[model samples]
Target: MPLDEDLLPEARKSYRYQWYVVAICMLAYVFSFVDRQILSLMIEPIKRDLHLSDTQFSLLNGLAFSLLYSVMGLPIAILADKRSRPLIISIGVAFWSLATAASGLAKNFVHLFLARIGVGVGEAALSPAAYSMFSDMFPKSKLGRAYGIYSLGSFIGGAAAFIIGGYVINLLKSVDAVTLPLLGEVRAWQLTFLIVGLPGIVLALLVFFTVRDPRRRGLRRDADGGVQKVALRHVIGFLWRHRRTFAAHYLGFSLYALVLLGMMAWTPAFYIRAFSLTSSEAGYLLGVVVLVANGSGVLFGGWLVDRLARRGHTDAAMRAGVIGALGMTVPVVAFTQVGQLWLSLALLAVAMFFASFPMPASTAAMQVLSPNQMRAQVSAIFLLISNLIGLALGTTLVALVTDRVFGDPKMVGSSLSIVYGLASVLTVLLLWRGCRHFRRSVAAERAVGEPAAQPEGVS
Candidate 1:
C-alpha cells in the first residue's frame, strides 16, 4: 500500500534520459509493426502459393493476428500495470520476432495461421506497457507529442516493410529459392520474413538493459492516502460511470482505425491489381506515402491535440478525430474511383494524411481520462475492440465486398472505396457527437477527482 521511491522516473533521471527511453521504446514499436505488417506486401504470393481465396487470406492477415493480439493484450497489460514494464516489453519483442522468423517455416495455411497468432501474442505486450511507461515518464502537457513521436514508428516500420521489403521482393524475383544451413529449402517470401523478423531480438535486448519501469505516478489513492491495486469490479464501475465517453472513444476512433488500417492492408493489392504493377512497385509507392504523408499526419495530429489542450479545449482528441475524418472522406472515396494512375495516387496520399490522426489522439484521450493504474487495462480494452474493428473487420470488409458483392478480385479498388466511404461517414458522425460527451466526461472527472468512485443509480 506504500509508494516505492526508487521506482520514480523523476527520482534520478534527466529529461534527456527520459527521451532516450522513448526513442528505444519507439524502435521496439517499429520492430513490432514491421513484423505485424510485412504480410501486407506478400498478400498475392501467399494467397497463390497457399491455394487460398481472398476471404481465407483475410483470415490469416486480419483474424489470425488480431484475434489473439487484441485479446492477449488485457492480461499482459494487467501484468504491465503491476510488474517490470520494460522487461515485459523486452520478452514480447523477442517472442514476436521469433514468431516472425518461424513464419518462414510454415508449409500450409494452418502452419501460417498459428505462426501469425504467435506474432500477435508477442506484439500484444509492447504498446500497453510502452503506453504505461510513457504516461508515467512525461507530464500531461507534453503527453501528446511524446505519444505522437512514439506513434511515428508505425509509419516508419510500415515504410521499411514496403521500401526494404519491396527491394527484397524485387531482388528475389530472379531466384526461385534459397537453401539455408539448418532449413533445407525456403521460398523467396519466406526468406523475406526471416530477414525482417530477426533484427527485433537485438532491439529487445536494448530495451531490457537500458530501460527500467518508472514508479507509478497519478495512482488512485484512498482517504488514508494509501495506494491500492484497483480491483476488476472497480475498474468496470469506473468505466460504466464514464460509459458515454469510452463508447465514443472506442467506436469513433475504431471506425477511424477500421478505415485507416484497411487502406494500409489492401492498398498495395489495389495498385497491383488495378494498374498491373508488381508488388514491389506498389510497395515502393505506398511506402513513400505512408512515410511522408501518414507519418507527418500523425505527428501533426499529436501537435494539434497538444495545441488544443494548451488553448483549454478538453475535447481536443475528439475534435481532432472529427477534423481528420472530414478531411479524409472525399479523397478516400474518390481515390478508388479514379481511372488515371497519377490522380489516384495523389488522392490516396491526401487520404492517408488525414487518416493517421486517431493514432496519437486516441491514446492521448484514454491516458488522460483514466487514472495511472487503470491506464493499461483501459488501453488493452480499447485495443481489443479497435483492432477487431480496425484490422479484422476492416480487412474482411474489403475482401468480402470483392468476393461476394463484386465477385471479382480486380474490383478490389471499388471494394476499398465502398468500405472507406461508409466508414468515413460513420467516423465523422460518431466523433462529432463524442466531442460533447468527452467534454462532459472531462468536467465530471475534474469535479470528482482522479479516483472517482462509481456513484449509485446511474444505470
Candidate 2:
C-alpha cells in the first residue's frame, strides 16, 4: 500500500503538534457542519416563510448544495495535492462561513438556493486536503483514528446545530419576526442563520495561523528515481488499474452514506410528525443522540479498524464497514415501525451508532490503498460521487417517495424506513465483496513496492 515510498518519509514533530493539526481540521469541520446543518432545525419556519412544498425544500436541501459541492471538489482537491493545504482550507472556512451568513439574507427560494451553492463550493475545499494531511502526519496504522478524530466534527456540528439552534430558535419563538437594520423584517430562522454561520470565520483564522502543512510523504517516483508526474490522467489510469477495489469501495461506502445522510436529513421531521414534538424538542433530543451515540460510535469504529488491522486483517476497513451496515439494518428499519416513543428513540440511537462506522473506514481504505499523489484526486472523485449519491439522490429520493408515492407528509417515517432498509441491504452486499477486492489490491500494490523500496543498485 505504500506504493509511494515512505523510505524517505518526513520527520514528524511532537505528538502534540500532530494532534493539534487534527484538532484544527476538526474544528473547521465542526463550523462547516454547523453552517450547513442549522437549516435542519429551522425547516418549518423556512418552509412556511418561503411557501415551499416538500419537494422544493428537498431540492434546496440536497441538490443546491451537493451539485456544485460535488462538481467543485475535483479542482479544489487538485489544488490540495500540490498546494499548501492549510491555506486552502482556511480560505474554504472563511468562504463558507460568509455564505452561511448570507443565507440569512435570502428573501426567497432562489436566494437561499444560491447561498447554499456558495456553502457547497466552500465546503468542497475540506476533506480531501485534510485526509491527505492526516496520512502524511501519522503512520498508516493510525490513519483510521486520525480521520475518525477529525470526523467527530461532523457529529459535533450536527449536535451543535440542534442544541445551539434549538435554544436560539426557542428563544426567538417568543418574537414573531426580527427586523434587521438594513434587511428589514425577517423570521427567527433567518436571524438564526446569521447567528450560527458567521462564527466560522474566526475558526478559519485560527486554522490559518496555527495549522502548518506537514511535509508531503510517500511520493510515487519513476524507475530512475525522479518524482512521477501528478496529473489527472495519472489518477484516472491508477483508478482504472484498480477498478474492482475502487468500484466496491466507492459504491459501497456511498450507499452507506446514503443511509446515514438520509436518516440525518429527515429524522428531525420524523420526530416532529410521529412523536408530536415541536422542532425545538426534536432538536434537543437529537442533539443528545448525535453527541452521545454517534460521537462515541465513530470513535469506537475507528478503534476497531486499528485493532483489526493490527491483527493482520488486510481488509479490516471494508470488513468493519460490512459489520456496521449489517448492525444497522434491523435498528434503522425497525425504528420507524415502532409506535412507542421511547422504543423508537432507542432504535434510532442504535442505528446512528452503527451508521457512523463507514466514514473513517472509507477514509482509511482510500489512503492506505492509493499512492500519495493520487490520494486527493481519488478522494475528490469519491466525494463527488458520494455526495451526489448520498446527499443529493438520497435526500431527493426520500422526499419524492414521501410526496408522490405516499402522497402524505406524515408517512415520512415510512419513507425513511423504505429508503434506508433497501440501501442497507445493498451496502452490505457490495462491501462484503469489497473485502476480497481490497485484499487483492493491497497484495498487488505491495508486490510492486517491494522491489522499488530496495536500496539503490542493490539488485
Candidate 3:
C-alpha cells in the first residue's frame, strides 16, 4: 500500500527547523574532521619526534584510523538505525574528542597509534546517523543542497585544522615545552593535539541538548505506531538487487576519495618540503584556498544538481558528479609537476575546487537510492569501502611511491601527482559507467514504488 501522507513524519517539522538540524550536524562533522585532519598538519614534526618513516606516519594518518573506523561503522550504524541517533552522535563526539586529546599524551609511536585508533572508533558513529537523519528531514528534491551544506564540515574542518594547527605550532615554536598539572612538559606537536581536541567536547554537549531525533520515514510501523526493525540480510539483498548502481557508486567515490585523501594528507608536506615554506605559511595559503575554492565548489555542485533535478533530470546528482570528476583530472596532475610555488598553489586551488564538486552530489545520490530503513547501514557500507580504499591507500600509496619507487621523501609532490593522476582517470571512468545504472535505479523506484521493491518489517 502507498504510504498515506499523514503517516509520514516529515510533515510536522518546519523546513527552517530541518535546516537548523543540518547546521548542527555540519558542526559535528566539523569537529570530527578537525580531530582527524589536525594530525596532517603536524606530520613532519611528529615524524621527526618519533623517528618514523613516511610509511609509519601514513599508518598513523590512514590505516590506524581507517581500520577501526571502517570496521566499527556497520554495527554502530545498525545501532543508529534502531536507536536514538542524536544520543549516538553526542557520545561519539565526546569520545573522539577525548581520544584526540589523549593523542597529545602519547609517549611513543605505539601509544599514538592506539590513540588514533580510539579516534577512529569514536568518529565511526557520526556520518551514518547524520545521513539518515538528513534523509528524513529533507524532501528528496532538496537533498542535494542539504547534503552539500552538511559536507561543508569537511572543508571547514580541514581548513580550520590547517589554519589553527599552523598558528598553534608557530606560537609554540618559541616555547620549548608546555607543562600541564599532571603531565610534565610536552612538545609543541603534542600540545597542538591537546588544544584541538578539547573544544569538541563542548560541541558534543550542544548536539545532545539541541538536536532531537526526528522520526524515521518510509518504514513500516506497527499498530502502536512504532517502527519495525529491519533484518540485516534483507538490507544486503536490496543492495545485491541493485548491485550495478552500488558497484559503480562505491567504486567511483572510492577512487575520487583516493585522490581527495591523498592530496589532503600530503599537500601540506609538499609545500613544506618542496618549497621550504614554514608550516604556518603552507597552512594559511592552503587553508584559504580550500575554504574559498573547495567550499564554493561543493555548494555550487549541490545547487547545480538540485536545479537540474527540478528541471526533470532524475539522474542529475550523478551527472553532476561526472562533470566534477572530469574537471578535476587535469589540474590535479598539473599542480604536482609545476616547479614554481605560486604556480603550484594556483593549480592546487583549481584542483581543490573541482575535487570537492562531486562529494555532495554523490552523497545525495546514495540517500535517494536507499530505503529509509537501510539508509544508515548503506551509508556505513559506502563509508567503509571509500575509507578503506581512500584513507587506507591514499596516503600509503604516495608514501610507497616516494620511499621505494622514487627513493626520495622530498619527491612527495611527484608521488602525489602520480597517484592522483591515475586515480582521477579511474574516477571519471567509474562515475561515467555508474550514471546509466543510477538512472535505471531511479526509474525502477518511481515505477514500482520504492517501498514495494523490498519486504517491510523483516526483522
Candidate 4:
C-alpha cells in the first residue's frame, strides 16, 4: 500500500532516526567484515608459520568459520528480535574483536581454530538484528536502496581490510628484517590480525551509543493482542505456505553466494599464482576493486530500487536483479577463463559491480515478503542456508576436487572457476522463478490485510 501523504511530517522526523540506525549498523558491519576478512589476508603467513597444507588452509578459510557461524547465527538472530539489538550487537563486537586479537597468540591449528570459531560466534549477531531494524526504519519503496547502502559496509570494510592489512603486514615484515632484540618483530600475519581486531573495540562503543530500538508494531495481531511471536513451528508453517517463493529466492541467493564466496575465498591466491602479484599487491588491487566497483554498485542499485518502487511497481526493483544475474554471469565466466592479468582484473571488476547490484533488491524482497514479527527468524534462516551451504561448501568443494583430480595447487584456480560457472546457471534459473512469483507474493500479502507500518528507510 502507498504511504499517506498526510503522514509526511511524522515520517521526516523518523527518517533522521533511521539514518542514525543505519550509520551505527554500517559501522558494526564494517567491523564484522574487517575481523572476518583479516584471516584471508593472513593466510599465506599463517601457513608459513605453522607449516600447514592447502587443504587445511581451505578448512580454516571455509569450514571452521562457516560451520560455527552458520549453526549459531539463527538462534542468536532470534535472540536479537526478542532482546535489545544494540546491546546484543555491542557484546558481539567485543567477543569477535577479542577473539580476532587472540588469533595472534595461537601456536597451533587447534588454538587458531578455536579463535576463528569465536570470531564466528560473535559476528553472528549482525545480519538478523540489523535486517530487522532496517526493515522497521525504511518503507518498502525505499527498502531496496536502504539495504544496498547498508550492504556497502561489506565492500568498504572488506576493501579496507585488504589494503590496510596488506600495508601493515608489509611494515611488520620490514621490522622483522631489521631485527630489534628487546621488542621482537611480529610476523606479518600476526600483525595483520592485531591491527584488524583492535578497531572493533571502538566500533562496539559507537554501536551502543548510537542505535535505538524503533518501537515496531506488526501488520497483524494474534489472540494475545500483540504481534505474533514467531516460533520454530511458525517458521515451518510459513515455509509450507510460501515454499515456492522461499525456494526460488533461496536457490537464487545460494547460487549467487556460491559463486561470489568461492571467488572471494581464492581470488587472493589466484592473483598470486596467475598474476605473480605479491600478497601486498594483490590485497591493495583487490581492495581498490571492492571499493570502487562493489561500493558504487551497492549504492546505485539501492537508489534505483527506491526510485523504481515509488512508481507503483514494487517488483520492478526485483526485476533488475534478474538482469544482474545474467549480466554478472557473462563477465564472471569470461574473467575466470582469461589468462592475462590486466584483462582478468578488468573483467572481474565488471563482474563484481553487476554481481553486487542485486543485493539491495534481493534483501528488500525478503523484507517485504516477511511479516514484521517473523522477519528476524526468517532472516536467520536465510543466513543459515546461505552461509552453511553456499559459503562453507563453495570454496572447500573446489579445493578438495582440485586436490584430488589434478594433484596440483595450480589446478585449484581453474577448479574455482568451474564451480562458479556451474553456479551461474542456477542463479539465472532461480532468479527467473523469483521474478515470476514476485507479483503474486505482493498480492497475497495485501489480501491478508496491510498494516499501518511506520515509514522508515533501510540503513
Task: Put down candidate 3 lDDT per residue, 186-270, tens digits, no spaces.
Answer: 8999999998899999989998998889877777555798865687796898789889998988999888888887888999999
lDDT of 2 by residue, 1-459 (tens): 233345323323356688888888998888888887888787788999999988888888889989999999999999999999999999999999999999999999999999999999999999999998888878767777888899898999999998998899888889988788988997788899898888888888998998889777778789999878789998998789889999999999999999988888888888998899888999999999999888988888898898899999999999999999999999999999999988998999999999999889999888888888778889999999999999999999999999999999899999999999999999999999989999998899998872112111100
Give candidate 2's error at residue 164 in angstroms.
Answer: 1.0
Per-residue lDDT for 98-143 in model 4, tens only?
A: 9998887677888888888888888888877888888777667667
lDDT against the true structure, each candidate: 0.88, 0.88, 0.86, 0.77
Better of 1 and 3 by TM-score: 1
Query: What TM-score quantifies how close candidate 2 is to the native fold?
Result: 0.95
TM-score of 4: 0.92
**Selected candidate, larger lDDT, 2 vs 3:** 2
lDDT of 1 by residue, 270-337 (tens): 99999998989988998899999989999999999889998999898889889999999999999989
List TM-score per model, in order: 0.95, 0.95, 0.93, 0.92
Which has the higher lDDT value, candidate number 3 or candidate number 4? 3
Superposition error at 332 for model 1 (Å): 0.9
Residue pairs with clashing backbones, model 2: none
The regions of model 4 sitting more than 4 angstroms off are 1-14, 175-186, 451-459
